[model samples]
Target chain A: MKKILVAAFMVLLGASWANAAGTAAGTQIQNSLTLDYEVGGINQTDINADDGNGFLVDNKNDVLVTTADVASVKVTPGSTAQVLTFTVKNEGNKVQDFILSVSDAGAAFSLTDNFNATSQSIFVESGTTPGYQSGEDTETYIDELAADGEKTVYVVASIPASQVNGDASIITLTAQVATGGTASSQGSATVNDTGADAEDTEQIVWADSAGETDAVEDGKHSDASAYEVQSASLTVTKGSCVIWDPANEGTNPKRIPGAVVRYTIQVANAAGAQDATSVVATDVLPGTVTYGVGGSGLTQIARVVTEVCSCTSPGTANTGNVSESTGTVTATYESPISASETQCAYFDVTIN
Target chain B: MKKGFLSILLIFAFSSIVYADVSIKSQSLQEKIINKQTKWVKATKVIPGTKIRYINTMSNNGTVMAQNLVITNAIPKHMLYVDKSAKCDGVCSITYSVDGKAFDVPAKLFVTENGKKRVAKALEYKAIRWIVQTLDANQSSSVQFDATLE
Candidate 1:
């Protein structure tokens, strides 16, 4: 009876130890079992024996994971080609092969506001362990990335020449792990056989398990940058010409009292990609000069030329007023000056 | 406890005695031409060589009058001071400084030119000061000067 009871107790303890051996993925589960036995008679000494003490075993499974990141960039409109960079890391316990793709965020290419991707494929850096050889690989292939390994990639893009101010473009990069044949397989496989004597090929089968063995999770990252157009460089030039004799017209064209001096103000936009808005030209005649006047002390005025003198069509005429007390003259442009365009204004004052 | 309460009361009384109500406002002006008439227009944007007028208005809003009030303004960079353009309405003394440190009348202000002491040119004036003897409560006064952008 004692021997039977000891055998039953050992079996129960083995079952309990097996139940506590299950553990989370990616970690080893080590366990051991020990047994002690004793035999004795009521009047005699006891004999003891210990076996299977400190005998340990461990088990684990692989896990698959990945992540990606992209860096933002800044460039000016009409600038040369620029680079967009990204980093893809593999956090799984096995090697992974990643394929790359780049696309704009939904807006079709247009002349007013858009960016152009110069290359359809991404290029990986060279000399990286398990990385693709430079210049030989066109597609963004990782070849082999060890566990917790990462690779950097570069994509070239250009800003359209006609891109307007404050224009922006968002570029998304996606990396997907390749899976298929023996070369491209995902997760681990299991096999099961019911017959006692089965063929070697029939005994082994693939089990489609999802976690670490041959498994891969796709990674996606996106970044955007804006093209800032600079302000136009507007230059103003003023020139003065004197008219000494009013009645004689061409007589005495030098500075003199009671002479009328005509002034020309030219405003030009120097930048080819920018335009000037709300442009106005003003000039305050010095204390020595007074506003030209006609009979009965009525003030005289001048008109601004709307178009360039070289143009064949007559330019629009803008009128300017003179202040008798302050000797100020002003002319406001009716339209904004386009890039690389020039506008002029004319006014006249009398020498005090 | 009584001594601490009295200290708090004394601090409040000192703060009230030190506080005074006075305000200063400033603006820039430019001459505008309209229908052959010169009008003073608020200067919003000025270009090189444009003449700008700066007016500073001081007001005493407190119940007690303000005494020995002095107002000073430094000439802005890239600007040339117009000669004899500073003006004030009250019985005040106006002074000019070439270095923004020493102040005196225009005739007395001097600068070392070529190792010789000479009267500073109007364009060399760096700062302006106005000294008012007294300003009655609820009264306001204005000071103005003209400068040309270089």
Candidate 2:
């Protein structure tokens, strides 16, 4: 009886030990085992409880993403201080700083002729500013842009009056991760060096796990936008005033047939940047009026006067003659008149 | 003894039938930018600055429901995972890893900087994992996330 009782006790202890071991093994399998399911060679999927194999994960460091809103601009000639707005978006995962610049497109502008295009003077301003200053401020420092954040920038270009029509310039905006560097002197009023003030300094977050240094991957992204200069419109107008008499100048001029009349042709340019070259004015006498050369029956006018009227001083007058064959009077100006400048030509005719 | 052996064989066969027939399929997509708007396109060849999305579908064809199904994916090289973009259809728990070895919630994941621990940012995440509590038989579920090519 005693031997049988001891054997039974041993059996119970053995079962308990076996149960404990099985429970521990099952827990281990659940925690660390990679479970794979295969259904009759048709479907297969695997899952790793620990970091072994299932999905591939990689950390991206030094990812600097930047883009400009406006790709190009067209500026009309005579447009004073036109503003080209661009929104610089920081799609990177960190805060970054950017510098702005404007340069002539050069070969990129695709100019066949030596246009002598004037370099555009540009100024940088934030979105809130009312006006842009024309000094050395061109760089913009973005203090802290969270991931997927964007800021609007205004590029104010002072289009030179000398800029010809169809001229083009390109503006390039480059963004660089402001890790550590001396602040540029030409930065905007709101932009300053990263470490200029101790209290205002932003913390630099490293991109890697070891944290030995910030992972600097492609930290600079640049985009260029082209701006074309539009052409200026030019126009001319002409009129005549009757002179009652050249010898006896009357206060009130009348439209009498025998009265000596002075034909005045005024050539004026519209408000534009282009100059009108080789301006010439011609007038033909009617059958009812005679050339003031003291003759009748299609006689020629001896001379006519043409001068620049809008200059500071009276321009030199040139003498022109009327053709007897065609009964036409012609006057040519020597120099080209710029926009808003006028030239005048006058000749006398007597009514029959 | 022969009868007992037959009963054990029968139980083993029944368990095998219950655990079989789960299928998983995966696909990749890219986002195209047109006129300042975003449209998704199927990814064949990816380029830098492109946003990519990965979709994984898990289907159960067995007669018994699947329990405690977990899906995990590694962030591909030259890609930055978008923050908080991972999702699943059923009740699940999502977690992220910075070094791919260890995983934790986004707020709890930490990285050492200047000899101090700081919460890891979204771009620092290297991997994502999702745990599904249960999937009914003959039903399917999906998980997805977005990343940007570096």
Per-prediction fnat values? 0.00, 0.01
Off by over 4 Å in 1: A1-30, A35-72, A106-120, A127-139, A179-352, B1-150
Chain A TM-score, structure 2: 0.39
| Cα lDDT over the full model 2 | 0.50
lDDT tens string, model 1, A137-199?
A: 344455555434676765556666675544556554555543212443332222222234221
* Per-candidate TM-score against the hidden true structure: 0.30, 0.35
Q: Is the docking of candidate 1 incorrect, acceptable, medium or high quality?
A: incorrect
**Best model number under DockQ:** 2
- Residue A250, candidate 1: how far off, in angstroms? 17
Please give the DockQ score of every candidate, comma-separated. Answer: 0.00, 0.03
Candidate 1: residue A141 Cα off by (Å): 2.5
Q: Positional deviation of B88 in candidate 2, in angstroms?
A: 19
